[model samples]
Target: MIHPTVVSMVAAIRRRANEYMLRQLSDLGLEGLGPSHAGILGRLFQNGDMAMAEIAAAIRRDKSTVTTLVRKLEALGYVSRRKAPGDARKTLISLTPKGRALRPAYERISRELTELALEGFSSEERKALMGLLGRVRANLSLR
Candidate 1:
């Protein structure tokens, strides 16, 4: 049977996955970026512009952390922040053309990461794995 430490296994996987992602990004000449930025960029790519709070919620990060990530992306010219047209208080974040250009590479990396993570899994096994992981995530998010 498998070990009883699911949390430890999950943490180890996350660390290794982030390390793999950082290596890939470094090879692509994205030196300063980290896996944390992926959540923001991916959300923007899928949902278009979003406010800071929305981004934080989407990424499951706190507002302050999201702000810092956004600032780094802004400095790198991957994203831009502007005031919401309707409410000047809300800052809307959107991808620059440079950010959009990363779509293909990130897509490939995401696919390759999944493939590596599920190297031995069959289609049904992959589906079951995803379902289980989703439930795990839900359980954690309920805290």
Candidate 2:
């Protein structure tokens, strides 16, 4: 059985990481983009333009939630919706110029996060930690 101390520590660490990342994102003019928005933006950055359903599946969020996020992003001029050429009923979501400009700041914040998370770890230890995390993720996926 998992120890109570370990569970509490894990919860605390998760909360701290979330708060720190959100603050960093806000400092970069990414205000209003909470954890949900961050997940959408991250997916857009890596995968380029995608349909609303595609994004929802990629992020494992319900379509309604993603739609709300897309609406907010559209209002902020961070994303644009275009009618698919082949299918008029389908809309594709892509980032706008303003959104593209935020990529560098996003990357910097991610680097800062990595550095902070690994501050006390030796190079070997960091590598091992990363490997273990990847394995854990894979194991969970099998379930």
Q: What's the CA RMSD for each of the models?
A: 1.8, 2.7
Estimate candidate 1's alpha-carbon lDDT, on a 0 to 1 scale.
Answer: 0.94
Error of 1 at 66 (Å): 0.5
Clashing pairs in 2: none
Q: Please give the distance, in angstroms, between residue 10's alpha carbon in candidate 2 and its true position after superposition.
A: 4.1
The sequence of per-residue lDDT tens digits that candidate 2 reaches over residues 1-143 is 96576447757877887899898877766778765677788888998999998999998899999999999999989999998889988789999998877788777777888799899999999999889878866777899
Off by over 4 Å in 2: 5-10
Q: Give TM-scores for every candidate, taking all chains together and pairing residue i with residue i.
A: 0.93, 0.80
Off by over 4 Å in 1: 1-4
State the weakest 10-residue window (summed lDDT) of model 2.
2-11
lDDT of 2: 0.84
